[model samples]
Target chain A: MTPPTDPFTAFAPALAGPPRLEPTDVSYVLEDTSLGRMLLAVRDDGRVLTTAFAPDAAHEQHWLERVAQRVSPRVLRHPRPTDAVRRALEDFLAGRARQVAVEPDLALLSDFQRLVLTGLAASVGYGRRTTYAALAQHLGRPRAARAVGTALAGNPLCVTLPCHRVLPAAGGVGGYAGGPAAKEALLALEARSAG
Target chain B: MSLPPFQQLVDDHWRDVARLAHGLAGPVHGDDVAQQAWTQALAAYPRLTHARNLRSWLLTITHRCAMDHHRTRGRTTAHEDPASLAQAPVEPPPQAPDDVLWQRVRALPERQRQAVVLRFVGDLDHRAVAAALATSPGMSRRLVSDALATLRLELTDPEDPR
Candidate 1:
């Protein structure tokens, strides 16, 4: 048996199973807004992580899996953690406020997408619309208008980041994850509030 | 009315559930039993509508997990070698000083033990205990009374003939 010794058996006891991952508690609340049913998710520290529109059963499942993979598997349905953002959204949708006072946790977004979105938010004020080309220019990427549009199309923060305010340079309402009707409605609401 | 956040439920009743687990599942398997209950609770949380008596509901889940732990232990004891089983990790030091008292409670009949744990360790009233045990309020009261009598006799007379 000394001649048939295997090295791996000696370490088998130490190599039992995968290490346990700690649970990160992410809280969320779903509410009906002027646009449609909106699902807002926040980190344990109360920073807004996602603001998706009309999340159907499939969309809800996909969102859960995404958060579980990117964050932790302990995503919980909690209203208090998301209450402040929900109130701000309610006020903005009701035309009582021009903008939601939400600090977005863009940890889930790519660096380039974060750069483009933050640049657009900083340059464009409430009730203001900007062309994708203009936002790219503002970000110092003058020729990246198409790239900027693609980033905005995949915007995870949605209303909280004011992605609705960005439109096509050629004069159409442009594509919105919330749908074309939602984009037009949001623009109209912002126009009324700004006026 | 909308149910309160699942996190809130976990926060408020975690200690109670852990205590009940220790009482029901015993020290060795208590932590595992509590964790299992919370895992089950999280999966079924979204469909919960009412917020009334959430503690009782949680205790019910914990009881179910404790039951499952015992059932699994029963089957494993037959196949598992005694020497290897002795090498299993020891549970953390118990918070309660009365180890013997808890052992006696665990020795009680199943229903009586559950009733006592839910009533004392869980800090739930008789009705809540009833809800957790899926019995009537009257039966829960009788079970607790009977368990207390047995514990009292055993504690006073160390040589109780059973």
Candidate 2:
């Protein structure tokens, strides 16, 4: 009797019958943007042999191995974004104007800052605009728009909460975490969809 | 205290996750339940430091998600025929060798069957089972015991205690 040819034949073992695992030919790219480092791993067939994370080779290699063990070493075709960012991107692409879940990885913020970010996350909707002052008012401190802007300027997950959707009441594109070009692109994308 | 490595935790406790899923939702939907549970757990990983028991915490989340899925499905399935419920054949009871005993076990109320499966299949202690079912431990224990007694009576032969 011949065995299955693929090595990833044990991917999902808990299912009723034996599930055949097909080796996916894909490349996974991990970006540690805050640290200005990126790791790219190309899995030929099912085996991951070539892995690289620039700027800090040793630390990147260690982090790659650690992350690999928790998730499948075989990366999905595209770069993985934070869950919140991914959800926001999907909603934007699908022509929906809402985000269901916020990304949990908003590092470098105080607890109060996070609460403000959460309010901002909930405030911005698809195809609509809210001012920073409007957001501060919603948080029960109308005087805190500048503080709210500071919190949003440091937002780690860019598109998920549609932070780019916030603008000045005088009708200016407010500061964007991803910079003005990215914000312009996002707004244009949303505008094209709405049109 | 520094926590154990995430991979090590997942490797050590993945079986418990599967069993909990199976108990909450039978085999057909268990894998989806487990997958969604893992996703939710990973999303909640940043707050894991506050959790006392990782295993129980994971199980609680999985159980809640499974129950939510079941309720959503029940609402969606309300209009379906009750007779179609028997689409899936029941696996023969492991200890109940007699057909009569199997029939009696099948006839037990859904809550009693769920409590029994949580006890046996999930290997969850009585208290954990009660927590999973959102009921009192005494009630959970009574449900299982009463279920077993009913099976025993239906399957008993007058000739032997064995």
Most accurate candidate by DockQ: 1
Superposed model 2: Cα runs more than 4 Å off: A1-195, B1-5, B49-51, B75-107, B155-161
lDDT per residue as tens, model 2, A51-107? 222446464445444434433343333443233333434565455754423324333
* Per-residue lDDT over A1-195 for candidate 1, one digit per residue giving the tens place of the 0 to 100 score: 111112111211111112122234788777878787777888888788888774585666556556655665457666778889999888888888877888888876789989988887788989999998888888899999998888888787888888999988888898988789999999998888788
Give the C-alpha lDDT of model 2: 0.56
CAPRI accuracy category, model 2 = incorrect
Lowest lDDT block of 10, candidate 1 chain A: A7-16
Q: At residue A5, what lDDT does model 2 achieve?
A: 15
Docking class of 1: incorrect
Clashes (backbone N, CA, C under 3 Å), per candidate, total 0, 0
Q: Which parts of model 1 have CA positions greater than 4 angstroms off?
A: A1-24, B1-36, B39-162
What would the per-residue lDDT of candidate 2 be over residues B1-162, giving only the tens digit for each residue? Answer: 334334444566777777667555654456667778866765565455554577877777787888788787772221133443344334311222322332353466778876765665556678987998899999999998887776666555657655
